[model samples]
Structure formats: structure tokens, C-alpha cells
Target: MNPVLPHNTLDQLFLSARTHFKWLPKPVTDEQLHQIYDLARMAPTSANCSPMRLVFVKTAEGKAKLKPALDEMNVEKTLSAPVTAIVAIDTEFYEQLPKLFPHADARSWYVGNQPLIDSAGFRNGTLQGAYVIMAARALGLDCGPMSGFNNAKLDEIFFKGTAYKSNFLINLGYGDATALFPRGPRLDFDEACKIV
Candidate 1:
């Protein structure tokens, strides 16, 4: 078997994660996006309930639908991105927990607990979304994960008929660093970490 990326590889991912507004003329094919999810779904989820949903907006109409939902600054990059994934949470994620956690009663735990469901949905699904960003970078794709979009507008435009609702939007593609801002500051290990 081929070797996996080393510890430094993770640091590379951290280093590489940044806002990239400028894009190259490349297409992220449907199969490629599918492969990305197939690889990412392997990431762990709470009670095996995969609440995170992805909507790859590739067509012009889809991008147009997304524009009014974005804040003024995010409008252009999102439209230019090869693909924009509408990351969302499935409120009825328990329905799938049966299949995902066949050996356990994870589904019942969430059946009527809306608060617990909401917490689990947002927290766990956000983790899953983070996993997708890393998985995409591992696959040699650059990501511009942003949160300037209007969630209400997005939910109406993209999730109106579905139980799923928008969490955030991610612009995916090959990026041009020539247009990137200079690397910003970061917290040192001592400043951000604590061990008991």
C-alpha cells in the first residue's frame, strides 16, 4: 500500500487553509465531488448519525440562486468558484442513524429531543464539514470556506423542500495565490493549547 501523509502533512493542511478569492479555469467534475464525499464520509460522526449534507452548486442558475444569499463581498468568488458546496445539517438525521448505527439505538436518543438534536446537528455536522475541507485539501484542492451568506435566504433558496438546512457555504477550486492576502498571524502553541 502507498504511504499516508506524515505529521507534517497535517501542519501543511493548517498552513494551506486560507481565503482564496481568485480562481483558475478548472472544473470540479461531478464524479470528483462524489469521490470527495465517498472519501470524507469515512470520517467519524456522533452516534454514527451523519447530519452533514452537501449541495454542489455548479450551474449558472444555481450560482445565481446563491448570489442573493451571499453578503456583498462573497458574491463574486462564489459565483466564480468551480463548485460551491452548500454545507447543511439534516434535522431528521435520526432517520439515517438506523442504517448508519445498525447495532445501536442511536436513533431513539434523538427522536423527540429537539434541543439535543439541534446541538448534535450543528456541532457534529460542523466537525464533518471540517473533515470535508481537509479531505478536499488532501485531494489537492484549495478551499475558501466563508460565512458571509444569509442563512435564511440560503435555507429558502436551497433547502426549502428538504429537511436539511444550510450551515455555511464553501467555495472550492484551484486558487491563485497572487491575489491572496499576506499570511496572517496565528496563536502560538502555548497561547492556544492546554494540557493536564
Candidate 2:
């Protein structure tokens, strides 16, 4: 069995993690980005169908391509962040299940099933996006995840002629704490969950 994580680790991963909007001028290095994905990829997914694909937008050119897709309120924060990751899902991800889940005929399960493909791709892909955020936080980076963008336009610009589809965006960098708004309250367990 696995040992429970200590307090500081728990705090770093969840208790003190906050959604950041403003970022420091410092950049998130390519090496760190790779490390974040390396960690996140280890997380579980159904049938090991890891469909998440990321496009790290760090260069001026990439950011320009992403600009028009952003909502007005998201424009400034997204542009200022050192890196913005486009978390996406591959509609044809099952093509790789032969290698990713090779022990059995997992690929056959999704080959001709449109509903299954859509459900599994989006569900597992979204889980991987959450893992990306947690992995970034564990690596001492801050994250600002947003969905205030035109998905169709973003897909046309960034994912044309590909099976990949954007699910959301996350601005990544060292955060500027001074720019954070007051933290909000969370629902109590009684309000948010049921203890079977």
C-alpha cells in the first residue's frame, strides 16, 4: 500500500493551491513543462486511454494565434502569462491504445463506437487536464485555468486538419500574490457530497 502524503505535501497540492490570474514576469522553462507532463501522464485513466494533448504557447507567434480566441476579459492575463497551455483531446486516441493498453484488445472497444469514443476521450482528457494543474502546482508553479474562449475558432486556428480538439486553457507561471483577489468559500461536505 502507498503511504499517506505529509501535511506540507498535502498543503502544496491542495490546501493552499489557488487559481492565479496575474503572473510574474519570470518564464516557465521548457524543461519544467516537460517535467510537469511527465508527472501528469502517470495518473490513471480508463483502459489507460491517455488522450490529453497539450500545446504550450510560449512564443510570441503562438500567443498571437491564440489571441483572437480569448474572451475580452481573459485577453490581458493570458497574454501576460509566460506560458499558456492548450489542453486538448484527440478524437482518435484509441489508435494508440494498442500500445498504451497492449495487454488486451482495448483498442477494439472504441474503434467503431462514436458515443464511447466521445465519452472516454472527453472524460479522460479532462481528468488529465486536472492532473496537469496539480502537477504544475507540485512543481512550484501557479495555474489559471479558463474556459472563456471560442472553442470553434480556437479549433480552426490551432487544431485544423487534426483529430485534436481543445478542451480548455491554462495560463502558467510564477504567480503575483499581490494581484490575487480575496479567496472564496467552498461548499461544506454536507452540501457537496453524500456519505453513502
Candidate 3:
């Protein structure tokens, strides 16, 4: 059996972690991004569908292309961050299920089913996005995740002629703690959950 994580590790991953809005000038390296994805990909997904695709908008040109899609509030923090990851879902992800889940004819399961494709793709893809955040935090980077961008515009700009669709964005780097507001409260376990 696996042991529970230590307190500091729990604190780093959840308890003390904050959604940052401002970033320092420090750069998040390509190696670091690769490491984050590597860590995230190991987490579970339904039938291992693994539909989440990422576009790390680190270059000025990429960010420029992404800028017009941003909501008014997300522009500055996004542009200033060292990297903004476009977390997206591949609508045709089941095409790879034969390779990813070879024990069964998984690809055939979604070949003609649009509803299954949409629901599983989006749900599992969103879960993978959350794993990305945890992996980033585990690697000592701060994250600012948001969904305020124009999805259609972002898709046109970044995913044209592709089956991928934008889901959300996560700005990444060392954060400026001085710019943070007080942490918000969470609902108690009784209020948010139940023992079945």
C-alpha cells in the first residue's frame, strides 16, 4: 500500500498553493514544461483517453496571436507570464485509443458515436488539465488558471484545420506574492461532500 504524503508536500500541492495573478520575470524552461507534461500524463483517465493537448505560448509571436482571444481581465497577467499553456481537447482523440488502450477495441467504441466522444473527451480532458496544474505546482512553479477567453477566437487562431478545441488557459511562472489577495474560504466537507 502507498503511504500518505507528508504535510509539506500536501501543503505545496494543495493547502498552501494559491492561484497567482501576477508573475515575476523568471523564465519557465522547455525542459520544465516537458517534465510537467511527463508527470501529468501518468495520472488516470477514463479508458486512458488522454485527450488533453497543450500549446505553450512562450514566444512573443504566439502570445500576440493568443492576445486577441483573451477576455479584458486576463490580458495583462497572461501576456506578462513567462508561459501561457493553452489546455485543449482533441475531439478526435479516440483515434489513438487502439494504441493507448490496446487491450480492447477502444477506438471502435467512439468511431461513430458523437455524444460519447464529446462527453468523455471533455470530461477526461478537463481532469488532465487539473493534473497539469498539480504537476506544475509539484515542480515549484505557480499557476493561474482561467477560462475567460473567447473559445471560438482561440480555436481559429491556434487550432485551425485541426480536431483540437480550446478548453482553458494556465499562466505559469514564479509569481509575485505581493500582488496576491487574501486566500478565499472553502466549503466544509459536510457542505460539499457525502459518505455514501
In terms of TM-score, the best-performing candidate is 3
Candidate 2: C-alpha RMSD to true structure equals 0.8
Segments in model 3 whose C-alpha atoms lie over 4 Å from true places: none
Question: Each prediction's TM-score against the native?
Answer: 0.93, 0.98, 0.99
Q: What TM-score does prediction 2 earn?
A: 0.98
Assess the local accuracy of residue 116 in candidate 2 as a C-alpha lDDT between 0 and 100.
98
Q: Which residue pairs does candidate 3 place in steric collision?
A: none
Task: List candidate 2 segments past 4 Å from native.
Answer: none
lDDT of 1 at 91: 91
State which candidate, 2 or 3, has the greater TM-score. 3
TM-score (C-alpha, index-matched) for candidate 1? 0.93
Ranked candidates (TM-score, high to low): 3, 2, 1
Ranked by lDDT from best down, the candidates are: 3, 2, 1
Backbone collisions counted per model: 0, 0, 0
Question: How much does each candidate deviate from the true structure in C-alpha RMSD?
Answer: 2.1, 0.8, 0.6
Model 2: per-residue Cα lDDT over 1-196, one tens digit each? 9999999999988988889999899989999999999999999999999999999999999999999999999999999999999999999999999999989999999989999999999999999999999999999999999999999999999999999999999999999999888889999999999988
lDDT of 3 by residue, 109-185 (tens): 89999999999999999999999999999999999999999999999999999999999999999999999999999
Q: How close is candidate 3 to the true structure, as a TM-score?
A: 0.99
